[model samples]
Target: MCCYVGCVSETAIESIRRSTRVMLLFTELTAVLPIFFLLQERRPWAVLGLLMAGVVAIIVIRVRGTLLRLRGLWEPYSYARVYGLVAAAMGIAVLAAVTGSQTGVFTAILVGITASEFFVARPLGVASRHVGIVVALQSAAFWIVVVSTGHGDMVGPTLIGTIIMTSGLAYSVGLTYRWWEGVLKLEQARRDAAELATTRERLRLAEDLHDILGHALEVVSLKSELAVRLTDPEKSKAEMIEVQRLARNALRDVRALAHGNRRTDFGTELTGARGLLDSAGIACDFDADPTALTTSERDLFGRVLREAMTNALRHADPRSCTVSLAVTPDQATLRIVNDGVAPLQRDGEGSGLAGLARRVEASGGSFTARAVEPASFEVIASLPR
Candidate 1:
């Protein structure tokens, strides 16, 4: 099972970050609306408010552009333009403060703080630290202006508190964004690793196919050319027969490679089973009549035998095993019984056994695997003749 951190694509994360930034922008706009209402009480303040509102609009637009550039949605050159706009907005704010337009000064401070937050979209370390310093200085200057104008009581203690809180919040948001970016990088790395493994597997399979078929085709080609040159009918006939055998062998190899499972004969499987059982220190008693079964039955029984032997060796600590195959007029039956049975770990069969059962049933066969005794296991397969 996967851990609790959860897995998500990079695109979805970006969408969530974008939505969060937009919501922050709306929240800031709502917070600043009170300044506009205060400006309506006087002509100079009203005129200054109009000018500040225009400047704020420009700042907001530039901020959006900066965000796009930071997120890699825009060209790198676009960053310089956003920086220029941010500098202009700060300059206008300072000009308003020097001219003694309180409303203008207030607007400028708001824009300056917001412009500082944009720096969070930049790479971390020195740049972000520098932005933090700039925001702190702006907040201090704003507090000083509010106190000097005798409007400290109007804005209350929350004025300076808001600035400090905002700076901290912006820093936290930047760090979180960086952390999510790292997660996305790790996800991409995992995907690349999986792709590399698949490519390596394909290359290995290609090399195996080349080794298996290349020499055979070369031999057949040479023999066919020799046959064409031969004058004797007997010599040509012999070369053609050799060529046909080589072709059939090459075709079988290709089929085996494609299916990823070699076609085994029953006799070969029996020999292999004895060898395997002996190596595992398990005594085996095997009885079978391979000649009684037809070619198709032999092939199916061969697979069943291979699967049964493999499971017994891998899953059981058997001291003895018995394998028997019986062929009647209508059907063939194969039974594999082994001692030293181990309890199943999971509720159902493993994928290997389940797949084998499906293959047998699909061919009009019946398959059963179970514990026949406390310390013994059995597997039986019966197929139509």
Candidate 2:
């Protein structure tokens, strides 16, 4: 049924649910039987035995399918009928207690307690509070009747049994309900976690496509513009051919990415970034040692550099940019700073920076991008070594 999670078996959940329901119902059905002798004692007061039997009958009917809603066993599911029946049973028990002056009403009080605990309390959570109240009422009934009607000899056993049954009922009912509720909560959380993972992966892929296509198009623009200005036919044709090759490569990369087999190569991206910047007449200062970074860190920093360089070229008039890498004993940090960082870039109006932050934090790292004073923007990412 996948009731708990993807890997959990339907049989396991069914077994747990069935066993708990059976135990709870079994205890509930036998709740009044423990004090049978007390109820049998001198029904001469006013046919209290008949009333006791009536209470038991009503509760049995009410409890027949007390968990009907849980199993979806009912065709047109409803609790109105069960609620009315239990109410009637509680009323009868209450009436018997009020009128049975000399007879002990402890059994009647137990009837009320079980009805409230099982039928009302388990579903609505309101009747559970009455467990203690009715138990106290049962004790009062025992003491008052025992002294006047002479159940004094049966005092020790009756009191002991009442104490055991009430305590056990309260504890067992509550424990099972809370355990069931916890299982449901854990199931919901598992589903939410899976959905969140899938959504984040989609966002990551979108960011990758943005980095890939954004830079490719930017370089194509630059090469096409340079080709327009060239007077030599051969050089202009060569630049146009280079632009075509770059477009084809970008299209191939998009296909590879869609196939899910594409991996980031830091060296290839860095070389491409240098060419794009040179073509744009932007001088870049890059100080990096590739050996210090792991494969994943290299991929992450490569994306960082690509996004930063693309933003510099696309959004600003820039003559200079700097890309720096620093590795310490405990951490590796990458920083990309450019002088022509536009004012609009200060407050990120796009998902690129946000996606980078999500990726870095998911990998137990940190990322930040903010515009510095004097038209400069800085992007920094750090990972634990």
User: In lDDT terms, which candidate is top?
Assistant: 2
> What CA root-mean-square deviation does each model show from the true structure?
13.8, 5.9
Q: Which prediction has the highest TM-score against the true structure?
A: 2
| Backbone collisions counted per model | 0, 0
Off by over 4 Å in 2: 1-130, 145-149, 228-233, 255-259, 342-349
Off by over 4 Å in 1: 1-56, 59-63, 66-123, 147-159, 172-198, 218-239, 252-385
TM-score of 2: 0.74
Worst ten in a row by lDDT for model 1: 1-10
Residue 301 error, candidate 1, Å: 26
User: Number of clashes in model 2?
Assistant: 0
Clash pairs of candidate 2?
A: none
